[model samples]
Target: MAKKQTKDQALANNRRASFNYLIGETYEAGIQLTGTEIKSVRLGQITIGDAYVTIRNGQAYLNNANISPYKQGNQFNSDPLRRRKLLLHKREIAALDEAVMQGGKTIVPLRVYLVKGFAKILIAIGTGKKNYDKRQTIKERDMQRELGKNLKNYH
Candidate 1:
């Protein structure tokens, strides 16, 4: 018998947010999604390019994360742009709430994936980076790539 690979069902991801922000803290929270929504996520039908995390009334929410409706599911499909609630413990929410109070700091979802059959999101407590900081990051990335290329060629 052949063993099957265990692959996660990724719902969404915000790639560039990390590049533009300095990450301070991270929290993993479960997402409340419907049945068809879960199916769509398993099919990788989602986008988080412009998504953000928001806290209101002591609860965290995923805003602007587009989860495409399941093709075969009708009348049971969830809205693609609907705000989804994130399930986190009270302590985590309070900590995030305090961190968000800092200037220019906010909660941002970095990744959304499935674990143990449940949709989990990795949210970051982050502060925005300045223009000079972005430039420096670009320079550092270029330098690292060049170094790797040179080492490979030399070997």
Candidate 2:
């Protein structure tokens, strides 16, 4: 039998999530995807930059995530921006709901990756940062870069 190759890597990343919000705790959850959607995702044609998690009727759903239709899916392709259900434990869902309602935190998708031929998403609880906080982060990053360069010159 031929050995099957497994590609364990992130298909899409929300790089702006860190810059825009202070992420607290993270949870890994499985995503329910259609046939065409999964095929498109495997081809690296998904975007989660503006995606967020919301709880409805005790179930968690991913909103605003775009998974482009598979090129060869023909008429079986689903809507690109359709809300997808997230597979998380009941306890986890309750915890996230409590955090959002009481703690004033938001759920954001950090990244989407493939593990063991299944799609998984890393979700986090985050609080939005103020304008000054963003500026401070940029300033600190620049300073760190400069310091690293200065230290390299001394070696």
Candidate 3:
């Protein structure tokens, strides 16, 4: 039997999001991009490290996600740091807005990928970790690394 292939192709990842926040529910969102932006994205010239999601006037926008200008797109390139609309359902946007209004919850983009030739981003609800929580996370990571090494040596 032949194995099925996954159509989603990852373009960019926000590795720090996991380390900096306690992630909760996740959502898949579509990004509204211009011609040059899509071209840049196809070439993997995108960064979401400093990107975040915000809802305003019943709409969700992706802010601070940087997409480098296409080399051949002179006079047609959009601003790299301009906020882009996130194509989500009204109910989803309302839910996210509600979640964000509570305590320290926030919406953060985790990764950008392509699905069926269309760009998609994975976003999640997260709470900012305290300094002590960050330290604990680091310690746990170190312990896991050490344990993996010990297991390898034992085997």
Residues 1-155, candidate 2, lDDT per residue (tens digit)?
73332444679999999999999999999999999899898788999999999999999999999999899999999999999999999999999999999866899999998887788899999999999999999999999999999999989
lDDT of 1 by residue, 1-155 (tens): 63222334356768898788998889999889999998887777878887888889999999999999899999999789999999999989989988888668988888778776677888898899999999999999999999999999998
| Clash number by candidate, in order | 0, 0, 0
35-116: candidate 3 lDDT, tens digit per residue: 9999898888999999999999999999999999999999999999999999999999989999999979999999998876
Best candidate (score: TM-score): 3
Give each model a TM-score.
0.92, 0.92, 0.93
Worst 10 residues of 1 by lDDT: 2-11
Stronger candidate by lDDT (1 vs 2) = 2
lDDT score for candidate 2 against the true structure: 0.93
RMSD of 3: 3.2
Q: What is the C-alpha lDDT of each candidate?
A: 0.85, 0.93, 0.93
lDDT of 3 at 79: 99
* Candidate 3 residue runs with Cα over 4 Å from true position: 1-8
Weakest 10 consecutive residues of candidate 3 by summed lDDT: 1-10
In Å, residue 61's CA in model 1 sits off its true spot by 0.7
